[model samples]
Target: MLPQHDRRNSREVFIGNVPMGGNNPVRLQTMTKTDTRDVQATLKQCRQALDAGADYIRISVPDVASVKAFEKIKNKLAGDGYRSPLIADIHYRHDLAIMMAGIADKLRINPANFGWPPESKKKQAKKSGKSEIPPGLLAETLAPLAEACKKHGTAIRLGGNAGSVEHTNTLTKTRSAEFLVNQAVKYLDILEELGFYDLVVSLKNSNPAETTEATRLMHQRMQQTGQHYPLHIGVTESGLGVSGRVSSALGIIPLLREGIADTIRVSLTEEPEKEIHFAQKLLDVCRQNGDNVFEATCRDNMLYIISRTSDPDTLIAEAVQGFLTLPERNAIQHITIEAPGMANQQVVKETAAQIMQQADIKEVGTRFISCPACARTSTDMEKLCRLFRKELADYPGIHIAIMGCMVNGPGEMAGADYGVIATSNDKVNVYAEGVCIKRNICGKEAISLIREILIEDDSGR
Candidate 1:
């Protein structure tokens, strides 16, 4: 449960059967980049993400064919015992939303981009009856989507944007707040008429003022209607790399801190997984108390806030079975050393550098010892050393000294609570406090033995 000082409240709503909101952990979602019409590839990607800890999956059902794909994906996921909610991104066609909402857990409807023309333009579109969408007919068309989704037990996402309404492209920045609110006003009435209340609202824009101002107005109007709804907030299409993270963050932080957004997706052109990572960070930043702003790790060129940036390395060290940086250095937190002949010493070195540079720390994870890999390490020394380092990836807190042979391995690792050494091609030694407590046969088996030691030390197992 969140403490009183935290701004966001717990509002648990089940996606498929997975509960999100209110005292539960934040749910992570990712959209399948696959073409939705391809059933085999799309579901495969969805399941892959599901296996990778994605809590929910969203797919773009742009056309009728996409709905067919959705059905196929839904069935497969259900068969696999996957309960994460599936969200449908509907644009330019409410019919797609109507057709697929039965299988989908959520239907996203962007009012700004409702699939219709303005009253005047819509009349022309009707007269022509070609492929153009009209504005005034937006509500009439989407009414079916809302109705179908509700009857089928799917929730709705009524999306609003500050830059421009999504579907019609008719409303510009000059549009009044009253006009925007009126658009949603009509939408809510239609939704209410359909007897649908399982809905969330999203009011996002590149411009924060318009986003927030319109949100405030619409929220007040919803109050007038005596109905409460969840809101998903984001700053859409805000550049890329660090710039995107900052702009979206600045725009989103205000709304979240005020307890406005119930769900968030920081839209980015980067990989879909990258989007999920940043979304977690922003949510964390908003939930944090006092002035704990920099409590994030700057990893993979993305920033993630968990508490204080200062504590990230230490926590990672504990979580991963690697050593935390032993010394503090102002803005920097930890450091680890790597040397050769230790084949995976590179792993320790690279991880430490990334932990400091990307994870926003001052130092490293483990120390590496190298007598240098000569012409003779080809058989088992290199293989055993590499496996040893990789297996300890989860032991986050303790320092392990990787040394050259058993000569320096015994003494150089004196301060380390744990160490691994290659005794020869067929033998290895595990040392604790200068004593070889575990004897090893070569190959990957040595790594497994070392991991058992870490588990016992860390988990008291």
Candidate 2:
């Protein structure tokens, strides 16, 4: 496994208020799909995105003419009480990058500018009949832009993209990503020459493998060049919905675990908020890394809990479902997930069942047994029991139960580590190992006692 490399010494810059590079947690940035010309609608999204936990919001600044929405969005954030960093996504026009630096906190520019400065065509490469863009050409052009950003103390996203019209000769997926990395590095090197390093790097491609490969190569290239700059990684053009989430997860997770990227953007066809939502999860966990240069690791060993709400299961399952698939169907040796969204329920429950069930659920911890408070249950004992669950929510690896009475408490909590069997006696009898451990417990410490006992007895199966 590649050791987690502490962040490279890239100068830290803030977008809105979120910081990137340096030792800051990786920033999650997304591009708004809204037309920047519409101030009201654009500000609406800026608010909606902040509510969804987006660390940084990026607006497409196409020309000097469309600066109204930037101010409106900024005003909305100020008036509505949102402080998430706002980033401006610009392309081609160096003037936009420079001008926006004064208005916006950051600028995302394609180093190549899609073959601007007509002279680049000749200076980039010897006239090969086949159209091949020399990645260095983009960097040469970006030198002035980098200098401008340095002057403004503005952060710059050297967002290198190979999908532009200039990057038209993408013979294959690998080559396309290769072309992007070269373009980004060429641009980054220009920053280096100018002694400006307030930048983050990204190489986005639709193919997960290509994206992964490109990042791997770029990291190696940076290490060799002794340039410790932060990286922003994700699979670009990922189709919308679950498929897109899966694609980004497959590519971004491994890089994150190996300590490859400092920030991320999951490019989904859905709303920009959706991308930001997924991006936060990526930041919450570490990514998988491996020793082999070719075979990459996509998941860590720790089991993660995914809330079924908010399409969490679908989005996350698709990313790490290899060993956790449906019916446990795929071959045993074929369990490795090379990319994202590889598994389903069959893999998860079946594999977990086979391993844990064989050893028994007891090996893990207590299986809490509790009933939803309803009219069918008694009020005092049952209601009091339900409210006390908070006392043990953080205590993992233990089973605890709060049952009403003989009606269903015993049946429901047949195998709990601690069961409160309420009886006609008004005495609380604690059941341990399906046998009564205590009765008539009269204190606020009942939950605490059960918690201590459960944690003591359980061993991971």
Candidate 3:
């Protein structure tokens, strides 16, 4: 288990020599508002942001010409003895990403635009469903980009912005959160499959409330799936002046309290330097208010163990005992066991339960149980688990189980306080405190039923 700042234990990612997420201080990042093709102006803005304590400087790379400008900017910055990590913000031109792979320390790819063919053909794709590229094809298209980043040791940000893309017709506050989560998860899966794990995830919306909710949902999903990608959060098109600052702060601060954000940008419609100052202020508030925010939520005894071995369960149990022996053990907060193999949700849950019985470790508010998902999984187990976590984020003293398929699903879920078991034909059976309360509920209706049950349980109705 690595050291955590608040409740989150994000995987650490490096941009140039600077580390973001996990144990590192929440970083402040700002983008150069100047045209990236204007090397001198871009250089000036980057320098301004750098001087203002911007941890990472982003420049929009729209074409090959911009790639050349980026090279000049990178060279000039390094020649002047400034090693600030430079990010190439590529919206529709992933070719630029491949071109500047080694040139930039990080590449920002918007999920909404990267898959669509070059800017000119984007209109053609937008006319139909071509814009929504299939996951496998999307992954194939991004493989070269991933390879280039891997070759250069650069990180990728799967940037999801509400302003850049239209929402599905079914979009609501809740559905919008799901939409963002699905976009992020789909892109992240593609990146992971391509063996590019040096990544950050962000879900940005112009609306402050939606921005906050989407980021929270993304965090919960990543946690439930055991993906430790760092998050870069902000409110997109956050306008200017007091309103922009207020909206951005409103969106970012709450997540910061929950230890959900890793790096943040204020995205003010003002000077790039202003963004740096505003972001720093937001981060300061997050730090100042952290103690009060996390006083009740922080669990000092929880430990998340990460290892690559055949037997993660035994290793996790041993870690708990070893963690207890340390003099500074009391300082530990939460632990997440991340072993490459044999680290499924059932194993993690059973191990945690066994450890709790042996140790006096207090349980957290919500407990999630889900299958790791295989060919036999009849339902989207990962999505269900994440949605449960999101809905149950504030609910305490509830154990929720999400299982796919019937093999070990029943037995595994029987241990949970409440369970949603996926049977054949895409139907779910809901259990309450280990008792089957409803059977043969299908589709989204199952989720609604589970929510009602939990709400009733929480309200003691």
Which candidate ranks first by lDDT, i.e. highest?
3
**Candidate 2, after superposition: displacement of residue 49 in Å?**
1.1
Residue-wise C-alpha lDDT for candidate 3, range 266-343, written one tens digit per residue: 775456787887676566544542211111122465565553434432334233333333455445555555545564
Angstrom error of the Cα, residue 385, model 1: value is 41
> Tens digit of lDDT per residue, candidate 1, span 40-109?
8677767776775667777877677778878888888888888678998775565566687788888776
Where does model 3 exceed 4 Å of error? 1-7, 117-131, 166-175, 289-461
Candidate 3 overall lDDT versus native: 0.67
Cα RMSD to native, each candidate? 19.9, 21.5, 18.0
How would you encode candidate 2's per-residue C-alpha lDDT over 1-461 as one tens digit per residue?
12336444444556546777666777676766665776776777777777887777788776555566686778777887786767887755666676787777777766545334345454435355434455465456566767777777778877664434243232222245667677667667767777777777777655566677888888888888877677888776554434345556667776766667777887754566767877776554343221111222223343333323223423353334332332332323222222223235444343333223212222332233443221122334434543454465444455566654553355445445567765534456688756777776742556667766656655532
* Candidate 2 residue spans exceeding 4 A from truth: 1-11, 118-140, 165-177, 284-461
Name the lDDT of candidate 1: 0.55
Report lDDT (Cα) of residue 238, candidate 2: 50
